[model samples]
Every structure is written in C-alpha cells, then in structure tokens.
Target: MDKQTILDVLNNLEVVDQQGGDEAWMLVDVTPEMIEELDHVGVEKETVLKYGDDESVCILALAFGEKYANFWHKGQLVNWPQEAVDLIEEMESALRS
Candidate 1:
C-alpha cells in the first residue's frame, strides 16, 4: 500500500474502547516486508483502528493499560518490514488484546 492508502486505513480504523483509562497506543508504518510478519502472526487490517493526527505521515493510535503509543511512519503499509509487523502483532496480543 502507498502512503495515502496506509493513511486512509489508519484514518478509517475503529476504536473498540477509547475510554480505557490505561491503554497503549502505537502508530505503525506498514510496508511490503511487513506483510510476511503480519501473515506469520495472523494479524488483519480489521484488527486495527486509527484516529486523528496532525502530520504528513500515517498515525496509529494504540491504547492499553494507561499507556498510549503512537507510531509515525513516512512509508506506506505495504512497504513495512517484517520486524515492524512482528512488533505490532506482539503489542496487540500482549498489550491490547
């Protein structure tokens, strides 16, 4: 996916529980290399929900247990590296999920 496509996905994502007092947030940049990692961990785009941002890059809002993580990437989701995908999956499973 290109930068615009990734931004669209992130912008359109739905937040399950934004009220969670202690939630972690992460903004991840997806790339082609990351696809393998996502596939390995079985993470789908539906699992993610995006929010508003004030930057040129894609913004990923992840909230978990009083911790909010934001990831800013200049590249597109389709070009994300495997390491990036793995990190996202790990965070979702261990923290968010």
Candidate 2:
C-alpha cells in the first residue's frame, strides 16, 4: 500500500469503541484485510497471521491526544509494523483537527 492507500484505510477505520472518562481512547480492530494491504507495503504478514485464524487478529487502540498507538493481541500488547504505526499516528493527528 502506498501512503495514500494507508491513509485512506486509516480515515475509514471502523471504530470499535471509545473509552469513557477523562482519557477517551479510540479503538479499531485490525482485520486481515488490513494486514493484506500492509503486506503490499512491506508489513510482516506471517507474524500477524500466526496469532489467529480469524478475519481479525488484533485491536489498534489509540489515545489521539496523547499521541499513543498500541496494538492489542489476545489482550496483550504486541508490536505492529512501524509503517502502519506511523500512518495511524498521522491519521489520529488529522482527526484531532
């Protein structure tokens, strides 16, 4: 995926939930389709796939104001592709405006 494609995905992200209270966090599930797109852009496929066999394997939780992006897999924090992370952070920043 090129930069625009990645950005598009981020823009159209399917928000799963928003934590309540002072620190409202945005959550988006990381689907297999996302992985496929990222794979085209050099994201590691095998690593994400090995975690599960479903359409989605992880959740991308972002604290937009805090500039934090975390990948949650099976309730644990997991390292995601840096390119994807950078794209997500950019998207979050844009959303804040």
In order, candidate lDDTs are 0.38, 0.48
Model 2 lDDT tens row, 15-43 = 56646445544455567677776566554
Best by lDDT: 2
lDDT, candidate 2, at 38: 57
Worst 10 residues of 1 by lDDT: 62-71
Each candidate: RMSD: 13.6, 10.4
For all candidates, the clash counts are 29, 0
lDDT of 1 by residue, 16-46 (tens): 3322224534344444434344334443333
